[model samples]
Target: MLSNPSFLVAWVFKARYFPHDEILNSKKGSSPSYAWRSIHNSLDELRKGTRWRVGNGRRIHICEDKWLPTPTTYKVTSPPTDFEDFPMVASLIDPDTRWWKANTIRSLFLPFKASTILKISLSYNLPEDRLIWVGNKKGIFTVKSAYYIACNLVDTVEGACMNGLPTMLNLTTRGVNSSGFCPLCDKAIENLPHALLHCDHAKQTWSLWQDCSVNLVSLILDPIDIALNLLEKGTINDLEIFFTEFKGACTSFSLHQNPSATSWRPPPLGFFKINVDGAATEDSGNSSIGVIIHDSHDTAIAALNKVLLAPYTIEVTEALALLHGALFALEMEASYAIFESDALSLIQSINSGVVGGEIGHIL
Candidate 1:
């Protein structure tokens, strides 16, 4: 039910379960069920992760509606008294060229925000406004995503426990116990920082995960400070991997054992492997493409790096890089070459012999 916008709008309006022609049209009504009322009250939270994809922009008010990428509505520190009378978003766009008026937007909004708004391309013929669910990659809401979001918002205690922080250490400090000795390490008190960073097992685990070299025990004095630093700078994937490995290493040490190391294998003989990758900057829309050709022995034969023009999505950039890599291999006159890319969607599309979506032409 959460995944279907038309159904949700009907539900919110207390209309019949059947489809309605004016579902997207603005109307106010009420639902008698307490559960539905509760859900209706929480719609504001859902709106935070949703944005309007500008089309004709006729229905969207410049200052009231949120069409910008930023979370906040379009606003300025100080404005003219008649700012409320400013025209719809369509006014800022030139109908003849179907492009945003650069000078007008610059005068109305901050320079950075104005530039971001300009980069978004409108259709040659104006289309209807689209409400995109930014919470999911496909721009559609799901109960699973909503559940996770709710859990994140309401389960603070569970979050701290899962992070391996020692919340019970305060009991020992209040004279509830003689000492807060660590269960895993008998040498030090079982404080949050000590268990996660300063313990002997933690030190060994940190050494094994050599990519991140921060010595939290030495550099950070308070556990809260360390948490803040990590929260501010850490990537979700990096933090998850770090904690999983750290806990596994600690458990192995507790059992007086060592974890086995992983080994890398080379490609099969008689085939040349070509690896291609691409990266795009969100702020500037600039992209870079890279490709490398390696033999069965895992020795590099050729490499190329090229900077591409602005205004390309990450998927499009990756597809372009793959095409360039294949062309490069053809130029080298290589036989039985194996192309590889990190994008599984591109690989699947190529294997299926079906090209679709915005980058369909390029593929």
Candidate 2:
């Protein structure tokens, strides 16, 4: 609703039924109703993540409003006070060329900030300021994103520490009768970090799950920090697997139990495993399909690669690849073969024998 220019204009100028502009733009001289006050309070929270996309920038204030790409409003060591009228962001742009006045911006703002502001490309065709949700990729706001923002704001390390799950060291500090040594590894003190990440048992569990040695010292001090770093550095599938394995490892450790050993086993003596994969180029809309068949001894018996005519959705391409792989396996005179694909949804649909969707026909 806030993104609609017509709605905003009406609220600001039309006062026959509502005084939205007066209430929003100016402080209430007198006490407002409870509902009005509640709305005003919510607006304060909303303002934190909201920023303006520069168009003509006529409506954006130079110093007070959050028009910059950075999180804070524009500031300087010394502010000018002799001007007759406060400057708008439009004043910084060249009227003739419709480009930022580089020299003027450099003199007015900090060097880095001036460069950032100058990088903002403005279109003369779009003359209205656009409200953008800085928290989202598309600059559009949603209640789901707002809920997550609120959760992050409310969550704190202190709150987590006070949730009654005290470590052995914490219990000892509080005069509880307990051994301060780690239960898993008696060599180290049983602090939170030691129990979760540094103990020999914990390290072994992590190594088993991650298929690599665990280095406690290399990890972030806080789990939240590690999670945020992983979110930035890893893919969604990586995070999902990490969380699932970590949870199981922690549960097993708490129970003082070791994880059972498991190894990949090849298909039955007579059967072969056909692994199929699909790739699509997002820019060119081109796709390719590949398949490789391995016998019981895990030796590649046959392989095939075919360039698809046109790009298709990932699910469709994967289904097509699986179909091609099955045909290739039959052509090679394989009586019993297991089709495997990384596309879980396609595999599940094939197993269920219920294929009815966008890519269902391919299956």
User: Who wins the lDDT comparison?
Assistant: 2
| lDDT (10s digit) by residue, model 2, range 282-316 | 44455689999989998998999997654554655
Instruction: Record all residue pairs in model 2 with backbone atoms less than 3 Å apart, i.e. clashing.
Output: none
The 10-residue segment with the lowest total lDDT in model 2? 251-260
CA RMSD of all predictions? 14.8, 18.4
Q: Give the Å error, residue 138, model 1.
A: 1.0
The clash count of every prediction, one per candidate, is: 0, 0
- Candidate 1 local lDDT, 222-275, one digit each (tens): 444544565667655444444443333233111112322534344689888888
CA error at residue 153 for candidate 2, angstroms = 8.5
